[model samples]
Target: MKGMIVSRPTEGDLPVSLDDLGAAARERWGAWVTERHTSVVPNAVLTLEVEPPGEPEFTVEVMRGPRSINLDGTPVQNYATAAWLRSLMPADAPRVIVFDDAWSMHADLTYGCTAEGLRAGTVDHSVPGWDAGDPDLY
Candidate 1:
């Protein structure tokens, strides 16, 4: 019944502005970042780590939503993880699940649903940037 949410920036997408990012975080996590700017790390990439109480560790990334782009390229914006989470959660479930490890410099941001939830249809979402082909991918 517990999990984590992780996020990072994506390439070739609408450069997620600080304001948009803060709004998205507030909507999703109910918390706001006090400061915002381009990450000092090169490549314009960032990882937001999250750890929920008594839940499996997981992560999510901030990429251009699918609707925000076309095969030929164009400007568009769409719901990303929230929609995916809604699809996985039961319609009747109350209280949104969130994580506390919001910012970590060296943390892994890979979302993971509990085994029981996966079996019970409580959490069913595909993880991106994860390759099951590798022996240690999980």
Candidate 2:
């Protein structure tokens, strides 16, 4: 049986620092979040990976320079789409709100979904982001 859960800080509730965001996400994601590994991409780009349990994970990647973000991993079936994730994020103070909020995690749970139905896929095969277990994420 395969399953997937996707969640992030609700609107108006964002984290201050990148580290804080990751930690907050880990906690909200529940006990599934295990070890964390940090890998930076030279300057401002960073890639953080939590314990991977051979299941597809939802990832929200923020990049500097142009200051664009990419929500990768997971498919359109099991979890929330990239569009939904971005919309849920706070429009103002994405950083400060996360740290201040209590539970900043939003999940896509389909009621009456069986374990088999929970199996998710990828949104983009050409280029996948971090959480989805795609190498191009970093």
- The RMSD (Cα, Å) of candidate 1 is 13.7
* Candidate 2 wrong stretches, greater than 4 Å: 1-20, 34-44, 50-54, 57-59, 77-88, 91-138
State each model's CA lDDT, in order. Answer: 0.31, 0.36
- Among all windows of 10 consecutive residues in model 1, the one with the lowest summed lDDT is 69-78
Q: How many clashes does each candidate structure show, in the order listed?
A: 11, 9
How does candidate 2 score on lDDT? 0.36
Residue 108 of model 1, lDDT score: 22
The candidate maximizing TM-score is 2
Judge candidate 2 at residue 78 and give its lDDT. 25
lDDT over C-alpha atoms for residue 88 of model 2 = 38
TM-score of decoy 2: 0.33
What does candidate 2's lDDT look like per residue over 36-71, in tens digits?
Answer: 333353333434333346766644444443143334
Q: Can you give the lDDT of residue 69 in candidate 1? A: 14
**Residue 112 lDDT (model 1):** 46
Off by over 4 Å in 1: 1-12, 31-42, 61-138
